[model samples]
Target: MPVRRFVPIAAVVLVASLAACNPSATKSESDSKPAASASAGTDRDEAGSSAAPGAPAGGNGLSLSEAIAKIPAADEVRDGYKRDSFKHWIDEDGDSCSTRNEVLLAEAGRAPEQGARCALTGGEWRSYYDEVTVTAAGKLDIDHMVPLAEAWDSGASKWDADRRMRYANDLGAERSLVAVTAKTNRSKADKDPSEWMPPAQSAKCTYLADWTATKLRWKLSADERERAALETLAEGCSGTAVKYEAAP
Candidate 1:
């Protein structure tokens, strides 16, 4: 009986020893490695996300005045500027919605119903340029915040066709393209702040901010008169801030 009992005791000790040495023998030990790795991965992900708010790291928190000061002052050249130099209103995603339609769709006060081929109907829009309210889409024009010609005069004349195309159809910034009445847009055609401003008195400050933001975004230069005009206009827009993302 003593011999049998001793053999059983030794077998139990051996089994326990094997379990301690074998990774697969204990379920908790096997799961602990993956669990620790997952926890480390989670910590890394949180760290990466914490740094995202300041990312894109282009231009985030600049006062309107400070932003305007960054644009280099130069003489504007209208030479060789043509409307066709920049191709626009493209269906960039083949969604059948042209850049023009896309702007209209986004700025509509009442969302329009989209149909086959991106046909839009039954929407209301408030044209901030003139403060006009309209229900018809045809009456609206998608105005480039910085007109193509103005862009050309500033510095885009030197850019390649592809870059010019991107400028013309810039949807990356909400302020880059605006929906406004056709009349107001035509009235402001190819004119900088020095020559034109929104007819609505309330919209002037916002307009200046938009113009400044767009110029800064594209690294566009401002002429002497244009800069002066911007300064004068900015005076009325106290406590205003400009935010923009640099164009790629």
Candidate 2:
């Protein structure tokens, strides 16, 4: 298999490793999909990163995994899942910064080793979600894999704002709104997988696994068009090593 590449974005933002996107923005009713840069969709730059442990960054495009799609939809459990149930961005420790700040450290490659107040003093970001590479952490945004409003539409409206925030700021079990190129993040704002895809064509397989796992875990599903698109992508990943579920 060919190796995958990591392409940096236009105006680079320096970081310890992963970028630390500010978490103060309010949710928009319309732009639930990832944000798109003016350059249009994802910009696949031909750069590469040292392979992370999991699966090799090369494989087939999007595809469904029985394991990932197996979770039964818990529309009932999500009944009272308001945006306020899960308190987010709070100081996980008694430190000054919030959970979001901690994520910058955990995800970024350049973050400092130890600090009481956990500020992401050092790191650099390389967003795979969008082909555009981000050097400076602040320039990028920690995008929610599934937008709030969209989640609401999918059955999160009943959830308190706190619960919504937890999902938005989820860093556990690989669930999160990770840092990615602003353009790609915007383009993926609220739309489902059926609507758009990353500019990096090589990452289709990884993207599909992540998407499928998240949707399944959250008890969410794609609408008619969205489901069809996901199913189509899954067909391409039929015989690859891509995992549809995060390991225990």
Candidate 3:
């Protein structure tokens, strides 16, 4: 496969023309389905200020402090786990675009030509995981912020199939699913924050915030070692914040 390339002038011009053709063609994170209702046994902090099951507290989501506090720590269980357990890439809204295509459309810096059946021809995107700029959609992977295996180990092993599906196909938050270079996504395969981090140093803060927020949103637990790693990383990310709606 070809390495990252500069955004071609023709692609830029094409995107601009598309924007002119349809003023509302641009997509945002909120365009996805409504927030899932909070579950009955939702966890909350001691202070009772975090019980509300809704979108992230702040417009940006949550501060590192808030996100860390929300995570429930527990021993992980990996029994009978399989990647196939979480069914993903569904066309949730009946649009031709699946979850993967929706992410590509939402994250693309320059819009691609949408052929029949939501086939994306050309676009530009920056893989924040490694700071690589890619033009071909084929070269990018829609990464689950918290990998499926990691989620199962953390707390998802106990969740029902429906909840797991919601977690996998989540598009309610911008930080949940990301478009990154295929290389970086594979390299990060199912590792927690303790085991791996983004290659781009500048992305570390945002990466941690997203990871933490995703865990809290889904009510997933972190093992002692993983929590320790996140706390240590949080120390360096001083004013950074995470924004995500709690996954129902």
lDDT of 1 by residue, 123-194 (tens): 888777776887889888889989999999999999999999988987655557777889999999999999
TM-score for each of the candidates? 0.76, 0.61, 0.76
Residues 167-198, candidate 3, lDDT per residue (tens digit)?
Answer: 89776545567888999999999999899998
**Per-prediction CA RMSD (Å):** 23.2, 12.6, 12.1
| Model 1 stretches astray by more than 4 angstroms | 1-60
Alpha-carbon lDDT, every model: 0.65, 0.47, 0.66
Q: Who wins the lDDT comparison?
A: 3
1 or 2, greater by lDDT = 1
Error of 2 at 30 (Å): 33
By TM-score, rank the candidates, best first: 3, 1, 2
Q: Residue 82 of candidate 2: its Cα lDDT?
A: 48
Error of 2 at 80 (Å): 14
Worst 10 residues of 3 by lDDT: 6-15
Q: Which candidate model has the greater TM-score, 2 or 3? A: 3
The candidates, ranked best first by lDDT, are 3, 1, 2
